[model samples]
Target: MKLTVHTFASLDGVMQGPGSPEEDPSGGFDRGGWVVPFMEEDFGRVVDSWFARTTELLFGRTTYDLMAGYWPQVTDPDDAVAAVLNGSPKHLVSMTVTAPSWANTVSVIADDVAGRVRELTNRPGGELQVHGSWRLVQALHEAGLVDEYRIIEFPVVVGEGKRIFRDGATASSFDVVETQVLGSGAVYRVLRPTPFTRGAFSVEDGRETVALDV
Candidate 1:
């Protein structure tokens, strides 16, 4: 199973909340629906594409709770996102959530979460997708587990909110494999993580040149 992350972020990398103002108010995040305005048909199509490859789901406690509160209520058969989320096998990473109320919650990893997830990746599946699970995403990133990132970057700069790559996050680079421009000025990007690289601009033989550190 390839671990993939799907998220909506602002231009400033804020991924706190993109659905509704009441979605995530953690740490007094007032700018919750920054990505709402940018959600057009193109955006919906991209989101649908993510679910098309989802065989399982990974979630942090908070994100799982948030999704459970909403997705289960959306019983629309035509809603691709809701259908996949409500029906897929979900793995929750939490100590407090001993028994999840959500249907199809197969397992909960309280201890040895990274190891458990590593084992999950070895299972037969297409994509074990993670959505809106910022904290879990951070841990997976640090564990070098995430295979790809599908992000929709809205053209909004949230002054302050929880960012995807917050300060002191695992320093890694990404190779942008795919990109698309939505009608609402949002950019959808698919990135594969890569090792962090460094380079320096120096004056060599009276010419400015870039010296890449190997």
Candidate 2:
């Protein structure tokens, strides 16, 4: 089982609420639903393909609360998007949430989220996917537990908002796996982590030589 993270962000790196104005306003963010109008069929196809390969989902408390409040009551039961979301197994990480109201949901409030997530990744499954949890994503990244990243970079730029990448976050490199351009000008990029190659340095005759081995 591999843990993958999927998220959308503005060109300026804002990952604040992309659905509704009231979804998140911690930083007085007014441009909440900025990603909807730009959504295209090509993007939808990309999401569908990605979800089809995922076996489970991980979400933060805020995102879980928001999604639980809406996705279950979606009027279009036949909609493919709703079906996938409603059917996936979800693990919500929170210290304050005593009970989860959503169906097919579980609560994981341990102090070591990275350890638990790594344990989950070692289990038998297709893919454990994380969505819309910037904080949690950063933690997992720092723990070096994320296997792949699917990022959709929108063309718009919001000068200030909650960003996907934060200061002092872990430094990890990736290899591009897939890239596509949506009709609405969003760029979809998929990346997989590559093994780190350590370099050796040797000094001889007052000169230094470096060699890298993978």
Candidate 3:
């Protein structure tokens, strides 16, 4: 079982509050729902296609709460995505979360998230997918637990918000596996981890800034 992590991010790398204005307000982020206007039919089709392949879903506490509070009540409960989300197996990774509000969900309380995830991936069945859990995704990436990454790069840039890649986070290189251009100008890129290649750098005798692309 491969673990595919899917997330939408701004040009500046912010991942918080792409769905609604009031989704997350931490860090004085006022520009919520920045990715809404870019959702076109082509984008929707891409999403639906991706969700169709997922057999298991994982999320963080906050994202789990947000999704559980809304998706279950969608008017079309039998809709493809709604049905998948409502009935599919879900794993919420958190230490403080006491209970899950959604049905067909379980809480994973392990501190060694990567190890737990690896165990899950090695199980006998389908692919596991992670959606909109930046912290957990970052941790998985650092641990090399993520097999594939589906990143929808929106056109807008929110200078202040929770970023996918932040300071002090471990860096990993990715090779582009696939790319799709949405009608909304958002580019959907699928990346897979690859072996790192060394790059040359000139060493200066005096003080200098070493530019590292994270």
Tens-digit lDDT track of model 3 for 23-92: 9876777898898899889888888987899888889877888899989997585588888888889998
Over the full model, what C-alpha lDDT does candidate 3 score relative to the true structure? Answer: 0.84
Local error of candidate 1 at residue 183 (angstroms): 0.9
**Per-residue lDDT of 78 in model 3:** 55
The TM-score that candidate 3 achieves is 0.89
Q: What are the models' TM-scores? A: 0.97, 0.87, 0.89
> Could you arrange the candidates by TM-score from highest to lowest?
1, 3, 2
lDDT of 1 by residue, 17-136 (tens): 788899999999887877777778998888889999999999999999999999899988889889999999999999998879899999999999889999999999899999988989
Give the runs in model 3 whose Cα sits over 4 Å from its true position: 75-78, 201-214
Q: What does candidate 2's lDDT look like per residue over 84-190, in tens digits?
A: 77888888889888778988885565567987888788989999998888889888887888889999999999789888779877655679999989999899999
Highest TM-score against the true fold, candidate: 1
What is the overall TM-score of model 2 with all chains considered together?
Answer: 0.87
In candidate 1, how many Å is residue 167 off? 0.9
